[model samples]
Target: LIKEYLPGVSILFPYRLLKTEDPLPHSWDVTSDTIAAWVAKQTSALFIKATDVDGIFGEEKVIKNILASDFSEHFDSCIDPALPEFLQKNKMECIIINGKFPERVIQAVYGRPVHCTTVKGNI
Candidate 1:
């Protein structure tokens, strides 16, 4: 168990129940932006999202860097519906790093260039 290995860790679980028809109970309609705001204000944590690709791309073209506001404009085409809406509601800086790479996680956390979708704002 995590407590047995890491005693200093504290966990917070904010559970929400969706519609009865929905099968997933743990996840709500919350957006990534909302989560980011909470992270910034509530915890001293770094928010990073790892995915299957290098980053946010438009029609096969990769967008190296984009501000939060810009992301909102292009969000409909780029983001998935299942993702929390907080990502679009708040300007949370998140990186969609590559999950396949062995060191992608470390690179993103350390500010290194990793293949992924890096969205700093709404998009």
Candidate 2:
């Protein structure tokens, strides 16, 4: 489906969504965040997820920028546990922003100063 809409953006949606015969593994660790990142990888695009929270909370604060290693410490709380590993292995970054503030998404995409969290692949 992504290829059919090449150069365009679309969130990852499983073939049958909640239906059975799941093409992908059925695991709690493989949530929407990981699926979105996987689609971006296959398409060579950026990955983003707008969640309800302000951003990734860590060390008693909303971490604006963090390495995958450090973020993994709080990964289970912020996102699918497998995402950090996948991003690290692929040398990719994921921008997590608050859906309440849609404008922040644009800033994140531009790598600007936004009230969001950027999870980097490297140390």
Candidate 3:
């Protein structure tokens, strides 16, 4: 559907097989962050990640724009266990926007303000 809608965009999907004895059997051998970092290095393109929420929140559900440097400080409380450490290792400037809003994609691509988690770090 994405290819059909956006004709010129290029997409690459890499898959890995893991043994059950491994810690994360259901997850990819590489983390999403790692893949994102590789993509950025290879293409020099902006990587935007859209999720169900506006962005990561604190215990009180406060919404704040977080820089990559702040991730380690907030990692324990903010990160989703399913996400791999490699993905979060570098501040791969990714935006965690709300996917429910269709226009959010457009806004993100156009560099507009949108609710998201921006990881700031060397890519």
Candidate 4:
């Protein structure tokens, strides 16, 4: 249904069931893990995470690029604390942009420069 109506947009709801005894996972944790697992099977993958904010910020300014190894665990509000570790483990990269701006997302998809933060995992 999404493909027939959405044209180019693809949205996946990252959800899964677990045992009652198991602890629930955070949405971002599930998403990050899912992306990591998917990337492991593919030859290449580009993770474009669209969120409400422009990108990760430092000192109130947007950080254009940052290594996953350098990402602070304290800032889990913007991204899952597990994301950096997952990215580093998978050697994958994620481009974070504001979903409010569709043009920027399209630009990121086409490998064009845009206002976003790139989390480099190839450490």
* Cα-based TM-score, every candidate: 0.57, 0.75, 0.59, 0.70
lDDT of 3 by residue, 7-123 (tens): 787556434312322334255444664555555544677876666677677675635565555455336533443333434464356666777886987798899876566655544
For lDDT, candidate 1 versus 2, the one ahead is 2
Stretches off by above 4 angstroms in model 2 are: 3-26, 71-76
Query: Can you write out model 2's per-residue Cα lDDT over 1-123, one digit (the tens) per residue?
Result: 333455675444556543543434567878877877876776798788889987777677888788877754445556788788878988899888898887888887776788878888873
lDDT scores in order: 0.55, 0.75, 0.55, 0.71
* Sort order, TM-score high to low: 2, 4, 3, 1
Candidate 1's TM-score: 0.57
Clashing pairs in 4: none
Residue 10 Cα positional deviation in candidate 1, in Å, after optimal superposition? 6.7
TM-score, model 4 to reference? 0.70
Lowest lDDT 10-residue stretch of candidate 1: 16-25
**Clashes in model 3: which pairs?**
33-87, 68-120, 96-117
Off by over 4 Å in 3: 1-6, 15-30, 73-91
Candidate 3 structure lDDT: 0.55
Report the number of backbone clashes for model 4. 0
lDDT, candidate 1, equals: 0.55
User: Pick by lDDT: which candidate is best?
Assistant: 2
